[model samples]
Target: MAIRGALRELSVQLSLLNRQVGARLELKDVDLDCLDLINAHGPLTPSALARRTGLHPATMTGILDRLERGGWISRDRDPSDRRAVRISTRRDRNAELLGLFAGMNTSLEHICAGYEDADLELVADFLGRAAEAGRIAAESLTAE
Candidate 1:
């Protein structure tokens, strides 16, 4: 119960943070999700992205279309499978994206600076485990 409450609180806080940051930067949730997905999984097909993001394939198409139109991502013929296309982040924006991520990390680190090393480690471990559990839960929900 405590963990669930904590996760809910964290989700709320993160959503608020995202909205604030997004307002300043003009980023939409889909744009951020697409960037995050590509950053974590490298190049992927639209179907693969849909699976990873738990979005409908048609929804993924719209997301990809918007990102492509914005020049944040590009698609190319998959080297190993000419019949399939893969989407990836644009090379020119790599540094800019990395900088933005680093800045967010720094902000988070500063917010966590009051914690002791062991406390921080424990929190990190818990969050990692919880993330994996959440992913499983999401997959199961989608399956149903």
Candidate 2:
């Protein structure tokens, strides 16, 4: 019960934080989510992105369509797999987006400024383990 309550609180807080950040940057949640995933993972196929993002394939296609129209991302046929398509951030626009995020990044850095290396390491370990547990639980639920 305690853990569930804590998780609920964290979810609420994170959602609020995301909304605040998105509003500040004039971006929709889906756009930010897609950009964040692409920035973190380099290029990926639409299906691969759907799996990674927990979005439906058609929804992912729509997201990609919007992003491409906005000049934020580009898609091309994968060289190694002609049937598969790969998507990547558009270099010029990506740079512009990165520049826009620079201020937010600095603010985040300030928030972490007081953390020691050991404290940071512990936080990372805890979050990684928690994520793994969540993944396993999700897989089990899907299997059932």
Candidate 3:
């Protein structure tokens, strides 16, 4: 119960932080999340993005358009499938994104600095599983 409570607090705080970051960059919360998705697992297709995000296809189109207009992402022809499009974060904006997150990154580093390597590994594994659990919960809700 203690860990779950702590995680709930962390989730809310992270959401707030992401909101602030999104506003600073002139992005909507959902758009910013989509951008993060692209940055993490992209060079992907619009359909794949929609699937991963659980957003409707039409909504994904609008989000992609917004990101492209903001110069946060680029839509290009897929090399392997010329008829399809691939989405990717713009290389030029990497520094800008990283700069926005620098403070948080630094703070995270400090927080982790005291932890032993084994402890960090355990924490990382826990976080990964937690994320997967969240994803599954979301998928179930979406399916409903």
Q: Best by lDDT, which number?
A: 3
Candidate 1, 74-142: lDDT as tens digits: 999998989999999887976766665686689888979989999999999989998999899999998
TM-score of candidate 1 versus the correct structure, residues matched by position? 0.81
Show pairs that collide, candidate 1: none
Expressed as tens digits, the lDDT of each residue in 1-144 for candidate 3 is: 899999999999989999999999999999999999999999989999998889999999999999999999999999888999999999899898889889999999999999999999999999999999999998888788
Per residue, candidate 2 scores C-alpha lDDT tens digits across 1-144 of 886788789778767766765666566787778877887796988888877767778988888887888777889889998998899988776666667568767887997788998999887897789878886886666456
Ranking by lDDT: 3, 1, 2
> Which of 1 and 3 is ahead in lDDT?
3
- Each model's number of backbone clashes? 0, 0, 0
Worst 10 residues of 1 by lDDT: 17-26
Q: Candidate 2: global Cα-lDDT?
A: 0.78
